[model samples]
Target: MPQAVRTAIVGTGHRAQLFTEGLAKRDGYDVVALCDPNSVRMAFHNRMLLAAGRRTAHLWPPARYDEMLRVERVELVVVTSVDATHDRYIEAALRAGVRVICEKPITTDAVKAQSILDTVRETGGSLSVAYNYRFNPVHRRVRQLLADGAIGTVHSVHFEWMLDVSHGADYFRRWHRDKSNSGGLMVHKASHHFDLVNWWLGAEPHTVYARGQLAFYGPGPEHGYARDYVRAHGSSAADDDPFALQLADNATMRDLYLDAEGEDGYYRDRNVFAPGVSIEDDMAVLVSYDTGATMTYHLTAYSPAEGYRVMFNGSGGRLELNVEESTFTSITLRPLWSEPVDHTVDHEHEGHGGADPRVLAALLDGEQTEGAEVADARQAALALVTGLAANRSFETGLPVRTADILKL
Candidate 1:
């Protein structure tokens, strides 16, 4: 066996747990440090590390990131920080001659994305974005089917994602509700869907047009959801509100956010309908691809249930994927002038339909299975810029070209 890769993860939030737990359970990775603004959150992760039978990692403040890299002899940095902050850490790691495995979107806005693009070209460094949806067995089969021409000469795509109240309301209560921090859901969430379309068609985006609004969340009587309370932790108004998240009930949320609030003043259970939300709850986007294909996509953050529907139209036939989250999933092929066929996909493991482990293996151990290839920084940028174009369109009421956002 080769030497272990000394790794450190930035940000000690919920997402960071995936890397910490995955690294602890796997070989070829020695998680040496946790960098974040809150020492309380870092210490929480340290306890988790001990529970997994791994040695505790050194906790470093965000200000001392570079020093941690040098002192710990870190070779890889897993970035799961705030969306807008991704570029800062990525640039720093690349500059320090360290490899990076970043969570999706790469960065929130246009300028940060361009900076990352420039830095990657300048340093000739290694940066992989974890678009784990691509590793889901069902999605990988779709990629294979598309490549094998099961859907020949793809022309159009339609994708609609629905987030149920329980899952969707959480976003409204968290840091993601801020547009500046997360670039709205279009950047923070829909980038995953955009990347899926880009990868499935093996094409890049051409033009994008979008319209979005905060239809349900935020403090406005018009929304019919806002409670008078700012947060749910100590408010009687939030006790009866269905949209409110009770963080004190869950051990992780309670320990990670409620108990750690004094260190960072970040609340995990804010009122979903209270004021200060800048992100949209409903979004629609239209995109044209470099391969002469077009896609119509919609995302609803206030649905009664969770699931998504994606369809592909091609000269040879049409293919459809309907997933009711963890409940039901179906893939159908309807070839022109032929009988319709159904394809079944079985999930092999837990966590995002078994995508998490596969991605962890690829990122940490450099293990690449057929149909489960990792994404490069350029691909990450393409995904990010596509969302950026949609966001620009949402503001300007005009179609924005992907090429204009960031030069790839």
Candidate 2:
């Protein structure tokens, strides 16, 4: 058998654990080193590996990333860092002649995204954006149906994504509450939805107009949230607060975040209704695609349910898909027929509806699962620019052209 690919992962956050643990179970990949600014988080990851009976990876500070890459002989760098920091690691890996598999949104802004694209072009580097939703069995089936012309000549699309309190509230509690960190939910969360549309329709966005607001998770008396503490870990306000996530409550969370809080002073449970939170909780966008297809999309972070409803209107007929992801309910597909078909998709795996494992397999082993396509730099850039254009539109209150935002 061929030697395992030497890999290094930056950012020892919750997401990084998924990749590390998944790689530990596979043979063709070896996680050699882990880099992060906080050493406590790195220690937590090592502890996790030891607990799982896997070899603990060496840890390095963020400043020593280049040294780690060279000394560790890392062939591939897996970036699971914060959204704003993704471009930095991606550029470093490309410049070092190492391949990269980065978590989505590419970067928080247009300049960073363009910088990454430029570095990729300059270094002739290979980068794959992990848009794992494409690997979902139900989503893969949709792609197959679309490819097979189940809905001939797609003309328009309407997508609505709802994030329930458990998942959605977590975003506001962490670094994602700041636009600089996560680019708000538009570029951060909506990247997944936008990429799905782009891949499913085989088109890129041309123009975007958007409206968004921070109606829920911010300082507002009208929101009826009365909280005095900034963080929940040792605060009295969090004792019985439903909105507060006590890191000490769960063993895993305690070890990963609560114990790791000393190194970076990064609190995992910041008040959701705290002041200075700049990201929007509700958004509506209109996009025109290069393929002449128009899309109307809406994202609500605080919702009663966690799922999405997407409908593709075609010249021949319409294909509608509604997924309630939280309860593992059946995914309903209505093909403009009198009786629509309902598919009970049991992924029987964890993380992003079993897409995470498939993504890792494809990246590490070159394994091609159904509907899984390696997302290149250009495709990732287009999807990112689309959301960035929408963000620009939201700020300027005008329709923004994707080409202008890209300026490629």
RMSD of candidates 1 onward, in order: 1.3, 1.8
Q: List the residue pairs that clash in candidate 2.
A: none
lDDT string, candidate 1, 148-230, tens digits: 99979999999999998999888888889998989988998888888888899999999999999888877764856667888
- The parts of candidate 2 lying over 4 Å away from their true place are 52-54, 328-339, 347-349
Candidate 2 minimal-lDDT segment of 10 residues: 329-338
Question: TM-scores, in order shown?
Answer: 0.97, 0.95
| Candidate 1 local lDDT, residue 325 | 82
How many clashes does each candidate structure show, in the order listed? 0, 0
Model 1 residue 354 lDDT score: 89
Give the alpha carbon lDDT tens digit for every residue of 1-408 in model 2: 988888888998888888878777777778889999988888887876777677888999988898999999999999999999999899999999999999997899999998999999999999999988888887887787778887788999999999987789899898999899999999999998899999999998999999999878788747666588899888998787888998987988888788888778888899888877889999999999999999999999889788888888887677777778756545444565556666546754467888888887887778989777868899888778878998999989999999888855
In order, what lDDT does every prediction score? 0.89, 0.86
